[model samples]
Target: MVDSAIITDNSEVLLHFDLKLEDGSAADSTRVHNKPAKLVMGDGSLTPNFESCLRGLKAGDKKTFTLPPDDAFGMPNPDNIHHMERSKFNLDAPAEVGMIIGFTQPGGMEIPGIIRAVAGDSVTVDFNHPLAGETVVFSVEILKVK
Candidate 1:
């Protein structure tokens, strides 16, 4: 058994989850594959609101919650879309729809951008998360809390 309060800042947890879109379409589900994901709390990886929902949950507890766009991946920003010359990419790389390219940031972090479209000389890349701006429904089963 696991204490719910222990699931706080910097705590590590293992859980299986199913994520669904607003349309009731299944986006991701651990139940189907039976693999649990590990997550560290308060790492900025999960929004505060989303973390709040997990508060007081113990192991073996199953909970389903809905999160708005802001509480999830966040709203997509138009500025995250960048149009670059096709020549900027390596010819061998092959720019295709859904290809992810890593761009080096000022702090040396590699940011991934998905290729949205390719025109004559311009290639459109979007840095926004693929699930951004979409409300999410999560069904979570707490497997372990540490």
Candidate 2:
């Protein structure tokens, strides 16, 4: 019996990963929360470039790859920034800069948007990903592949 499997286009991969920003600051890490990430290859959740980097990796494999903004989260799009009336925000908890709030889409899906500015009756919300426009370092330790 084979003791291990390599990550393929349809493999289910379980791994611990560290995402670091261009400034060398830790952006996210599965090890920090002690929870490994699980994903099926070819799933739309990961960019094709990211999937390609993991191809053929097996359990116990360790790899680190740098992805530019386009390959990672893509650059921030101006269209993703929106300005809304201040009344739309909850009065109980006033919206402030750097606050992330969930906004429901037309399809009932919720997406997180960060408050960028609040001026009078106008509030600016950025829907771009937090790491958008930034290059990132992805360090992964493959735990299991099936």
Candidate 3:
């Protein structure tokens, strides 16, 4: 019932987060950008599970927790993997494995796709999120909960 000191629906929160993989390798961190994230609690930007973790947290609280693939970014879908002809790519810099490229959708919105493989004249592009299927640990330093 104490709304001022704790996170609640519609509360404006400012926090820094560190996202890491199961192997303890760094995935991403707000500290690296030096700009803490600002968002309203219960916003659609956060996954339901992630928001649940922040529900009771207050300013100056720091916590780290792990999320399964489903609750995190989610599992990869086979339908997200597309095969295209090598000719579809620019000849100057052809598609190569591990390359991330922006693919324009029918609505003109661009999404990132990773080049997974190249065999003969075929190119495989994975449209799944880069962190899909990952069990990640998210550490949050709550700066301002209201």
Point out where model 3 deviates above 4 Å.
1-4
What tens digits encode model 1's per-residue C-alpha lDDT throughout 1-146? 33654476777888888899988999888778777888888877667887888777768888999998989899999999999999988967878889998989999999999999999989999999888999999888888887
Off by over 4 Å in 1: 1-6, 31-33
| CA lDDT, every model vs. true structure | 0.86, 0.92, 0.92
Enumerate residue pairs that collide in model 1.
none
lDDT pick, better of 1 and 2: 2
TM-score of 3: 0.92
Worst 10 residues of 3 by lDDT: 1-10
**Colliding residue pairs in candidate 2:** none
Q: Model 3 scores what on Cα lDDT?
A: 0.92
lDDT value, candidate 1, whole model: 0.86
Model 3, total clashes: 0
Q: Report the lDDT of model 3 for residue 95.
A: 100
lDDT of 3 by residue, 1-146 (tens): 43358888898999999999999999999999699999997778788889998998998899999999999999999999999999999966689999999989999999999999999999999999899999999999998876
